[model samples]
Target: MNIDNRIKFRHLLCFLEIARQGSLARAAEALAISQPAVSKTLKELEEILATRLFERSKQGVTPTSAGLAFLRYAGPSVQALRAGVHSLRSGEHEAGVARLGVLSTVESSLLPDVVRRLHDQHAALVVSVVTGPSAYLLGQLRVGALDLVVGRMTDSPQIEGLTFEHLYSESMILVVRPGHALLQVDLRDRSRLGDYPVVLPLAGTTIRRYADSLFVQCGIALPQQRLETLSVALSRRYVQSSDAVWIAPQDAVRQDLARGELVELDIGLREPGGSVGICSNPTTPPSLATQWCCEALRTAAADYRAALYP
Candidate 1:
């Protein structure tokens, strides 16, 4: 069909706004144009398509059959354009920017290796890392502000349009400062480990959930007189300064453990661990920078697994 290319883009924008807002006044309000302007654009769009795209009535405008069909193609194109803008604005001419959110545990335990490996592979890649509780990062990811989130999947909120790929499972363990009394017993034995004061991660965190589950399975209720905090450093310090055992990821305190600064408490229960993953909105076509970051993270995960367990 012979069609003017200029009107197609304009018509698409105007029609999309009307379709989105469902009312001429609202669409005009949203577009910062007049109601007449909106009506004119819709008319032009209908003229180009040679069909009525909306059914006007007292109830407001609704998409016609033709409009419904066209939206399937148009919606994704618009979204892709937005994604492209994010990629370009972040300097697409350069390799790419990987905006990632890593969970605190992974940030401490697994991220260094992943980041180092990622950088080694993509020297030109600009890595922008944001750290936070899992829920906040997921929110950013949902709104298209972040490229990827590396965090515990258990505590993850429902983020529409996102895909999650499981990276690895990590055992939650009770850790304390060096020469803690709990380490003297079998960590798998719940009764012995429950005797000491506890330093716990916040109750609802993924790590804490696993830690709590293990305690429950061992038929031990954690001590009521316990200290709770979100900061891994603070939790570690609490354990170090006093006769307290803190439940956390072994990797989060790996350096302290290796340096004889902390010891894994013998909590006599076999506790299941939690899973970590990379999350992104799968509906949007990922930018080259995002792909680079994903690859880097995967490589980091691989190298970390080899170093930690191999």
Candidate 2:
């Protein structure tokens, strides 16, 4: 089938947006069209290509195998077209752009320094960063919505089609406010954790798995009075104002630790931490800006590891 004659750019746009959003209504909103219109476009594209694109359900849509395959080409093609238009409108040479996905683990420490150095070195380059759970970020990376992701390598089905490079290992720390009652308790007593309210990452996140494993290894049950979130701001606030213990990545609360705002509890689980790293779609060649950002991230990781180990 001659796709040039049968398919329009709008078809690719609609298809890509649906794949990204995983819902017809959400894709329609994003594309500024009615849901039926987006659905119609998807049907037309599927017919043209002689393949079913998405598997729809009450919750939303997920890309079929063919849809996932098509997304690799469609997403980059659309992004390139947008970059071209932006370049033309700005009357400047096409500056490189990298869309990055980040996990919360690196949000406070590794990401900031890397972004600062990237901008300092490439003033005209555009870097867009999106932070989310590793699973979601890796999904976007697979579909070409993200150039790369900085996060822990998870043993998840979504990680199947991507490549990951180990940068460092990140351990979870149990922390409390500066003068919490737990400070006087024995560090080895895991059961004492139940005496206080707890803040933890939402279930299913990579770090949360490690956090949960720590409790299991110690033969301690998760606290009944628990707050589950990935928001560092909320966890920090709650831990400081109340006797809530926060389970978080050491990197995430580094500043607070240094400032004596939070104190680490020494439960002393010897389990090795998760591998922190970079994940990218192996099929998508990195653009100039993406390559530069990758290098910056490696440098930042190197410095961080040296500081920790040295």
**Candidate with maximal TM-score:** 2
lDDT at residue 32 of model 1 (Cα atoms): 92
**Residue 238 lDDT, candidate 1, scale 0-100:** 77
lDDT by residue (25-75, candidate 1, tens digit) is: 998998899999889888887787788888999989987778766654565
Whole-structure CA lDDT of model 2: 0.84
Best lDDT goes to which candidate?
Answer: 2
The parts of candidate 2 lying over 4 Å away from their true place are 1-4, 88-90
Q: Model 2, range 64-118, lDDT digits (tens) per residue?
A: 8888788767877776676667667764556777899988888877898999999
Task: Give the runs in model 1 whose Cα sits over 4 Å from its true position.
Answer: 1-92, 155-161, 185-189
Whole-model lDDT values for every prediction: 0.73, 0.84
- Summing lDDT over every window of 10 consecutive residues in candidate 2, give the lowest-scoring window: 86-95
